[model samples]
Target: MTRRSIGIVLNGVTGRMGYRQHLVRSLLAIREAGGLPTRDGTLWPEPVLVGRSEAKLAEIAARHGLTEWSTDLGAALARPDVSIYFDSQVTSGREKAIRQAIEAGKHIYTEKPLAETAVAATELAELAAAAGLKTGVVQDKLFLPGLRKLKRLIDGGFFGRILSVRGEFGYWVFEGDWQPAQRPSWNYRAADGGGIVMDMLPHWNYLLEELFGGVRSVQCTMATHIDTRVDEQGESYAATADDAAYAVFELAGGAVAQINSSWCVRVYRDELVEFQVDGTEGSAVAGLRHCRVQHRSMTPKPVWNPDLPNSVPFRTQWAEVPDNDEFDNGFKAQWEAFLRHVAEDGPYHWDFASGARGVRLAELALQSAREGRRLEVPRLEVPR
Candidate 1:
């Protein structure tokens, strides 16, 4: 049996997502679950931690039992041991690291926003194409059990001729005032590639575009709801980035979708992320854990009476989605899939092009919000 030991250079290893998702879930979890299986047997993929700080890197390395740790990013890139350059860096530092990785002839995988703008994203895709190396980005939301069920319903025509999609995504993330911020301070600064539109639009873009339809045009309004936020240092800084964004999209299939994203709003629903789909034959609503469907035959009957304080007739008609062992822990599922893509010739669609498309969509959405006009999505002509 031939076993391939794939070396992965993990950039931004000290960050939250980098440490938790990429390192712990993808690397360490893969090990705990048994090595990635191939047709021949299985493969072992090792991770080398990359960061700018020695202390932080050392701390993470110690925690993770990683023998390889480095503050020098370039040396990690030049090493022959590293076959894959996994980037979980801040949005601002993403482009440079990815470009260098591609130039070094390594396959690449990264967190969202391939670049801050569509133009830069396009360039990166072109370069990766020229190099003939495999590239992928984390589109973890699509792999969620709830969304997977949603996709099944749509494909099965449960929502005959889908008409629209509505999504509410977020929770009240503390502003690092009394408690330390869960996210970095840079995420709320516009100059640092921070903003709700830039950070989250990518997730919506891929999921909506892939599940609902290709987004043709977008109309959006954004605002920095919190003007001042205390940083990790307990010093107040001007929050120039957007804390909230509301976007309405027109899809290629003639379906219209509205998405509301915010860092300030407390979740008033069953889940932190919820999507509601209304179609000609039926309507379905899904949260991260559960899915509910209401069909045409089971549609609710209502008589309007404003005198009553609050009365809705939509409860009895809906049926709850059944639990399945296959669908659980969306992030972990994506990790398993990525490992399969790495070790075997399994289907891998989370490529750089898809990642770039997400960035482009976010870029256009931001542009629409800024100019107070709808922006058309540009068509990409992939090189043959």
Candidate 2:
């Protein structure tokens, strides 16, 4: 067995995403799992911590008992010890770091929205491919248990011909009026690549494509529902980005998808996020962790009475979706897949090309919203 010792340079390891999702849950957890086993029955890569703050990096390193650390990304990239560069930085700052990492000839894995614009993301993807380095972007929602169940149902033809998809995704991210804000302040600034449409459309693009087909066109409207929010410093800042967006997608397979993402909405259901898929033969509704299905043949028909309040068709039609343990936390599952791709030489599906496509979708949605016109999505030869 050939033991491939992988050295990973972790950028943006000090952020909230870096701490819980990347460090403790992914890299550290893999280390605890005795590393990812390769086809030859040996562990492939080991993680090393890198960040901007030496103190915070040192703190995390101490917590995880990791010794390899660096504050200089350039130095880390140049090190022979490092074989992979992972970035979880703010959306605005991801491009430069990833570009440099690719030039360094290391396999790259990072979070979404490859760049602020579609062209830039496309360029980045080209660069990584030209460099012959393996690359992947985080597309965690597809691995979610609820979404997985929905995918299974779709694959098995449970819904028959798909008609439409409706999604509601949001929760109040509290302002720092009493406590510190949970998200980055730049997330509300347009200059910093922040907006509900830019932040969320990518997820829907992949989801819609996976469930139905590629998006042929989109119509969207975006708005800044909250004008001002206080940060941890007790200073009020004017919000310059859209906090809410309503988008409609026309899929190539004739399926329509409507997505509403907001920062001001309150959760009043099974989860903060939910979706309803209506098809020719049946319909289904899925929350963050659960879903229910109803077939037309199984649906009880009833008369519609405006005066009579209650309806019978709704009461007896829907059935609780059976629980399956194949799914886990979306992020964790993607992380595991990533490790497998690195270790076992497994085919990596969510590569840089896929990431670029997602960014393209977001850019197109933003353009459509601003111009008040529908935009066509260009199909790319993204790797499967």
Candidate 3:
């Protein structure tokens, strides 16, 4: 059996998502598991941490017991051993770094909304295509156990001729005055390329297209419920970005998807985000970890009797979807898939173009909200 090592230059890993998910949970976990198994041999992932703060990068490297850490991106890219570049940086800084990585002739994997704007994202896609580089954008939700089960039902024709999809996603983020904000302070600043719309609409766009039909049009409204919030330093600043977004999307198959994404709403559901998809033959509600379904044959009949006390067990009517296979963390799953794609030239499609489409959705959603009207979601063409 042959053995090989794959060096990955990981940037922006000092952030929470980058450190927890990409580092500890995914790449490090893969490394600790005796590398990723392949037909010929094993592919070991070696992470070369890169960030603005050398101190923070050194600390992380020390914690992981790994040594190749650098503060200069150009120096990291110069290493011939590093064949891949992974970025989990802020939205505003992603495009330039990705462009540089592409120029350096490295395969790339990154967080979503590939760039702050659609134009820059398209350019990156074009550049990568021209350079013959393998690229992937994070679409972690698609790999969730619940979504996988939902996908199984869709494939099995359980939801024959799907009709509509309704999703509710949110939890109240404490203002820094009372409690330190769970999210980064930059997330609420528009100047820093922040907002729930930019952060979430990309997720919704991919989820809609990959599972159901592609989005044909969109209508949306956004709001900033909290005008001011304290930062990590206990200094208050204006929350200029929208904290909530209510959107209605029309799919190509004539199905409608209504999604409400917010950071200010209280949670009453079983999960942080839940999607309910209804069709002619059945309906299913899926969260991050669980899925519940109701067949058309077993659906209950509830008449309009507002005067009398309701006795029907609406929630009990649906059956829980069993997990036939043990589920790994969604981020880890995607990381393995991407690794396989890079190692063996496996099939991968969540590319820069797909991410650009997501950015386009957010841009149009904002425009739709401003105009107070529905807008068409046009086909995106990346001119290479």
Candidate 4:
């Protein structure tokens, strides 16, 4: 069996999502599994962690027992041996670095909300296409166990003639006054390219389009519920970004979707994220890890009585979907697929064009909110 090592320059991996999800759980986990298997043999990802702080990068390398670490991104990008460049940087900082990487002829993978605006995201996609460099953006939710099960049900015609989708997502992010902030301070600053709409709408865009149909129109309302919040340094700052967003989307097949995302809302659901789909023949609710289904045959019949308490056990009516297959970390699954796409020309559907489309949806939704009216979402065309 032949073995090949693929050198990857990972930028901004010292951050929270970069460190925990992409580096520790995804890349390191893949390395621990003896790398990814390919037709040629095994393709091992040799990652060189790159960040702004030398101390932080060095500490992470030591903690992970990794040999390669660098504080200089330009030098890392200039290296001939590195074939791939991965970025998980702050939204405002991603464009320049990604552009340079594409110029350096490196295949690129990046976190979502590719840019602050759809135009910039589309420009990046066009640049990568012109350069003939492979590019991808993170769409991790599609690979979730529950979503996979939901997909199976959809494919099997379990939810015949799907009608509408409702998604509830969020958890309370403590303000830094009493407890340390759960998220970075920059997430509350509009100038820093932070907002719940920009952060989450991209995920919903792809999810709605992929699972149901293309989004044709959107109506939205965004709010900054908390105007003042203490920062990481214990100093109070004006929160300029939207903390919450309520959006309604009309899909191509006449399906409607309502998704609520907030950073200030308290959790009451079984999971941090949950999506309920209602259809003609059945219904299904999928959380991050669990999925429940209720077919027309097994649905409960209940009679409403205003004067008396309901006797029906509403929660017990739906049947839990069995976990018949092993589920891996969603981030790691995408990473492996991307590596294979880079190494052996494997099939990969989520490309830069797809990422641009996600950004376009967010842009349109924001416009809809600002105008206080439903707006049409035009399709984003990418050159082949």
TM-score, each model? 0.96, 0.94, 0.99, 0.99
Residue 127, model 2: Cα distance from true site in angstroms: 0.9
Question: Model 3, 366: alpha-carbon shift in Å?
Answer: 0.9
| Model 2 vs. true fold: TM | 0.94
Better of 1 and 2 by TM-score: 1
Report the candidate with higher lDDT, 1 versus 3.
3
Per-prediction tally of clashes: 0, 0, 0, 0
RMSD of each: 1.6, 2.0, 0.9, 0.9
* Per-residue C-alpha lDDT of model 1 across residues 262-376, encoded as one tens digit per residue: 9999878989999999999999899887789998998867777788855665666689877665764566666657767765657878787888888888888888998999988
Per-residue lDDT of model 2, residues 1-384, tens digit only = 556677888888899888889888877776677776667765645667777789999998888778888888898899997878899888889999998998899888998877888888888888888877788888888887788888889999998899999999998877767767768788888888888887888788778877789899989998898899896578898889998999999998888989899988888767788999999899988877788898988876677788887746474467888875666567767776776676656777788888888888888888898899998887876433
Off by over 4 Å in 3: none
Across 1-384, the per-residue lDDT of candidate 4 in tens digits comes to 777899999998999999999999998998899989999999988899999999999999999899898988889998888999999999999989998898899999999888888889999999999998888899999999999999989998998899999999999998889998899989999999899988999999889989999999999999999999999889999999999999999998999999999999999999999999999999999999999999999888888789998888899999999989999999999999999999989989788888888888888888888989999898789863
User: Which scores better on lDDT, 1 or 4?
Assistant: 4
Candidates arranged by lDDT, highest first: 3, 4, 1, 2
**TM-score, prediction 3:** 0.99
lDDT of each: 0.85, 0.82, 0.94, 0.92
Worst 10 residues of 3 by lDDT: 375-384
Error of 1 at 188 (Å): 0.6
